[model samples]
Target: MERLNKPLTTRQERFCQSFVIYGSGAVAARAAGYKARSSNRQGWRLLQSVRVRERIREIQASLADHRGRANDVIIGKLEMVYHRAMENYQYHAAARAAQMQAKLFQGIEETRAELAAAGIGRDDEDRDRETPNNSPELAGPKMMTFDDNSREIDKACTQMSTWKKRV
Candidate 1:
């Protein structure tokens, strides 16, 4: 007697090949002259026989192993990219903060020179004539503004420290 589960015929072979290549089982079944679309279910069941199932399982296992190795490579590459991007961000942030600090210092120095030129001090050698309650009470507002700016810088530095730790 002929086996009920024999391999596919030439027409069925063409159907399976077209289905796999084009990802359309209906089209494949129509191309194979299967009048009913339900014939695709029969084709699928035949393909899932014991021997075919074992072969499919083995192929899938091999593909999965290869995919695991490829995933490790991809993760390593992505981690390096993340590290480099973080380094660039940190470098630019530090440079910008340094530039701002330098500008603030320049402003302070200019205020000092102005105070010296005005000669409004108890002592000629006193460089801190801008201090509150010191000679030249007019420097109070400028000194208070500078102190506020310094506090803002300190707060910014603290925030950066916290953010760096989290990152």
Candidate 2:
């Protein structure tokens, strides 16, 4: 669902954007200027719409930029969910949040390794913060192609072998 065949109404568009920002249906609905009395119900109802769901996903993907800061945002949100679930004694929800966090960390580590293999090592990553112009294309976690991913994996294996021999 790239663009909605029929564009969302102004209120629906506002609700979608606000939902992403607030991560709360009722809050987002109110923020979107829905009627206060029925905002809670409308909020959940709006999410049930296929067009609304796709539009929201599209908006979220668009918000993700080349810098990979979206990963940090995702991790932060997961951590917040984990903490809230734990506080409420929702064991299943807390566990799911923790699992998502681990998966995110795995991807981050692989991206760092791939960047390292590309000669933009850890130090270079830090230097890149001060100079954002360097390696703009490779800065994001999802920037690498399948061939590049395969090459990075091979490089990582070779480095692991050298590390074992050094020990």
Candidate 3:
């Protein structure tokens, strides 16, 4: 039921309710008994009413509140699922979370390696002797050659520079 303080005709109230349900003003107008050919115009006119807009806002707020409650219910169910998974020794979900965590930390490792290569070694005694790309052990699993990687890095840096200048 509409809770608008402002006066509205029954048809106008129907228009608001139908609009909320269908998300199409023309369809709502038609449902509210306007002729199909003129539904769009009538819908636009009804939308101009302060009372109608207020009623629509009330409907939308109610729908949002319902959705919020529904989400809470869903989260509660998910928590139960998580507990059940843990009890059943289902490691897949835990493993997936760990994989995501590892991916997030991948950047940190790359930055640390880069910093070590820049003469700021992880240990103070170990001096930065050569570029990371030069060290076979330090070079990543891809085994990318120094020249190819260097060219790619240069190209990317150039493109970034061009983009920065444009921005």
* lDDT of each residue in 1-167, candidate 3, tens digit only: 44557688899889999998767889999999999999999999889777898889988778656534343333333434434444555544423333343444465568778997887755432224224565634522222222433543354445545663444
Give one digit per residue, the lDDT tens place, for model 2 in 1-167.
Answer: 43548889999999999998778889889999998999999999999888899989987777654234667668766766766765775655656666677788789889889988899756644556453667644444433222433443354445545663443
**Alpha-carbon RMSD, each predicted model:** 28.6, 14.1, 21.2
For model 1 the TM-score comes to: 0.24
Candidate 1 accuracy as lDDT? 0.50
lDDT of 3: 0.61
Better of 1 and 3 by TM-score: 3
- For candidate 1, write residues 1-167 as lDDT tens digits: 43546775676566655554334556666666676757677557535555444444455455445434343333333333333433555533443444444565576568778877899543442334345656555542222233544544454466666774444
- CA lDDT of each prediction against the hidden true structure: 0.50, 0.72, 0.61
lDDT score for candidate 2 against the true structure: 0.72
Candidate 1 residue 31 C-alpha distance from true site, Å: 1.7
Q: Locate the minimum summed-lDDT window of 10 residues in model 2.
A: 140-149
Once fitted onto the true fold, the runs of candidate 1 whose alpha carbons sit more than 4 angstroms away are 1-7, 50-167
- What is the TM-score of each predicted model, taking all chains together? 0.24, 0.47, 0.38
RMSD of 1: 28.6
Error of 3 at 141 (Å): 49
Q: In model 2, which regions exceed 4 Å deviation? A: 1-4, 66-70, 75-167
